[model samples]
Target: MKQTVQLAGLSCQNCVKHTTAAFSKLEGVESVTIDLDQQLAQVTTDTAYQVQDYQEVLGPLPYKVESVL
Candidate 1:
């Protein structure tokens, strides 16, 4: 499954690294690609994941999950 997650507060490469690390840790996630300029993440997973799940994963971070599509 593939999902595009719109994010907020991503200002640098460090934010991209952090976001990638966080999502990459999820059990079923295969890969995570972040576009720092667009503030988006394209995640490829082996299982279905909801927007809430993504939000929860990023809850403690400086970035916010604006939406999922």
Candidate 2:
């Protein structure tokens, strides 16, 4: 499965790295690609996951999820 997550408070490569690391650790996530320009995270997963699930994963960060596209 694949998901594109729209996020807020992401403005640098460091943010991308952090987001990538976090998503990569998810049980079914296969990969994560973050586009800093658009503040979008493209995620590839092998198992079922929800938009809110992704949001919850990022809750502890200094960022917030705008929506999942």
Candidate 3:
């Protein structure tokens, strides 16, 4: 499955990579694409995961998940 999530506090392209890597480490996640310019993240995964899982993956970074669709 694929999910598009609204993101906040993504200030640079490097941040995109950081976020992508975090999500990529998850068991179910196959891929992660974060567009800093668009303030969005496209995540592809096969297993069910919760939003809190993402928050934990991101650590204490100043980011907010505005939505998931």
- Measured by lDDT, the strongest candidate is 1
Runs in model 2 deviating more than 4 A are none
Q: Pick by TM-score: which candidate is best?
A: 1
Among all windows of 10 consecutive residues in model 1, the one with the lowest summed lDDT is 50-59
lDDT accuracy of residue 24 in candidate 1 = 86
As for lDDT, the candidate ahead, 1 or 2, is: 1
- Pairs with steric clashes in candidate 3: none
Stretches of candidate 1 exceeding 4 Å from the true structure: none
Q: Estimate, for each residue in 1-69, the C-alpha lDDT of model 1 and write its tens digit.
A: 888999999999988998898888888899999999899899999877777788778768888888888
- Overlapping backbone residue pairs in candidate 3 total 0
Over the stretch 1-69, how does candidate 3's per-residue lDDT look in tens digits?
A: 998878889998778878888879888888888888899989999976667777788887778777777
Collision count of model 2: 0
The TM-score between candidate 3 and the true structure equals: 0.85
**Ten-residue region with minimum lDDT total, candidate 2:** 47-56
What would the TM-scores of all predictions be?
0.90, 0.85, 0.85
